[model samples]
Target: MVQCLSHRVELAFKDAMKKAPLYSKVYSLMDELFKFYHKSAKQSAGLKSSFEALNITPCTPTRVGGTRWLGHTLTALNNIWKGYTAIVKHLSQVSVTTGQSATQPKALYLLKLLRSNDVITFAHFLTDVVAVLAQLSKALQKRETCLYEVHQQLLATISNIKKFQTRPGPELRKVQRPDGSFAGESLTGDTTQHSAQMPKLLTALVETLDRRFSDIDEGVLCATKLADMNAWPASLEDSTNG
Candidate 1:
C-alpha cells in the first residue's frame, strides 16, 4: 500500500514537471494568499468581524456565528473565480469559487477526497479552528490589553507541550502563580480569565499559525522580516504518528 502511494506521488510530481506551466500557474495563484492570510489576521478573517467588529463575545465553536460575514473565505484566490466574489454559506461543502469545469486539478482533488471512503482532509482542522476563533472574537469585542502578550506566552507553552508530548510523570500540579494565572497561561488576569476553559482552542490557534510560518521563505514579508523562526515546535501528528 505504501509503495503504491509512493509511486502515485512520484508520478504526480513527474507529471507536474512535464506540465511546468500548470504547476507555475497554480503556484502563482497561491502567491496572493500569504499577503492576506497571515497568522495575525486569520482569526479575524475566520471570525468575519466587519458586522460587529467591536462586540465579539465568548462562545463555543457550535455557538459561534460569523462564517457568513466575510463574503468569501477563499477570496484570496480571485483569479480562479474569474473575479466573481461569491459568499460561502457552508464550511463542510466543497468550494465553488474555483472557476473550472469537471476534472480541474484543485476541484477534482477535493472532490476525489470527498468521495473516498477512507481518507482524511485538513478540513477537519475547521473543527479546532472554530473554538480558537470564538475565543479570539471575544477578545476583540473588548479592549485587548494583554491578548498579544498572553498569546505569545501561550505559543511557548504549546511548544513545551509538543516537545514533551506529556511525558509520564507524577500527578500534574495545578501550577498557578501568585497572580492567580495558570503557570503557563497565555492570557493573564480576569479579562482573559472570564471564559478560559478552552485550552484546546488556543492550541489549535498555535498550530494554524505554525502552518502560516511554514509558508514563509527567507523571513521576508514585503521586504521586511516578518518572523525569524517558527517557534510552535513539532506538530501533534508528527510527535505521535512519526
Candidate 2:
C-alpha cells in the first residue's frame, strides 16, 4: 500500500488559517514584529543590548512559503506561537521608546493586533489544531509507518479537531501572561462570528481527510494490525475471520 503522505496536513492547516478570518492579520503581525526587531537591531545597538540585558533573545518569524514543503509551514507557525510573549514585550517597548507609528506603520499595526482578544484566542486555537496535525505529519513520514496506523491517527486527529471546535470560547478570549500588564484588544462584534466559524473549519478539515484518503480500504487497515507480533490473533483462522 502506498503511503498518502501528500499535503493533507498542509491543506488542513491552510484551510484553518483561511477560515480564521484574522489569520492574515496575525501573520502580518508576526512579520512586522520580526521586521521591527531586525530593524532595531541594525539601527541601534540599544535594542540588542536591552534584550541581552534582560536575557531574552529576540525571535524572528519564519515565512511560510507556499512553494516550500509542509514542514516549513509548521515551523513558521510554531515560531510565532512559541515566541509570542517575547515578541510582544520587545515591540511594546519599541512603540513606547521610538514612536513605532512614525517609523514603522506596519509594525505599529501588528503590535496592536497582537494585543487584541480575537487575535490571541485565534492564535491559541491555531496552535492547538496545527500541533496535532504536525505530530501526525511527522509520524506519517516515518519509513516504517503502516496503513492501519495512518487510519488510526487520522481518526484520532479528526476527533481532536471536533473537540476543539465544540468549545473554542475560552481559547478565543484571552492570552495568559504572568508578568505583562497587557490587556487584549476587544474584537467587539467579531467575538460571536469567530466562535461560530470554528466548527465549520473543523468540519472542512474532516471532509478533506475523508476526500483525500477515501481509497484506503478499511479491511486492509484492520488486517495490517496483524503485522505486529504483539497484536496477532491466537490462530490463523481467527485472524482471517477478523
For each candidate, the alpha-carbon lDDT, in order, equals 0.29, 0.61
Error of 1 at 112 (Å): 0.5
What lDDT would candidate 2 get against the real structure? 0.61
Clash totals for all candidate models: 1, 2
The sequence of per-residue lDDT tens digits that candidate 1 reaches over residues 161-194 is 3432233111112222244322122222232321
Q: Which residue pairs clash in candidate 1?
A: 150-186
Candidate 2 — worst ten consecutive residues by lDDT sum?
Answer: 180-189
Model 2 residue 237 lDDT? 100
Model 1: residues >4 Å from true position, as ranges? 1-109, 116-121, 137-141, 147-242
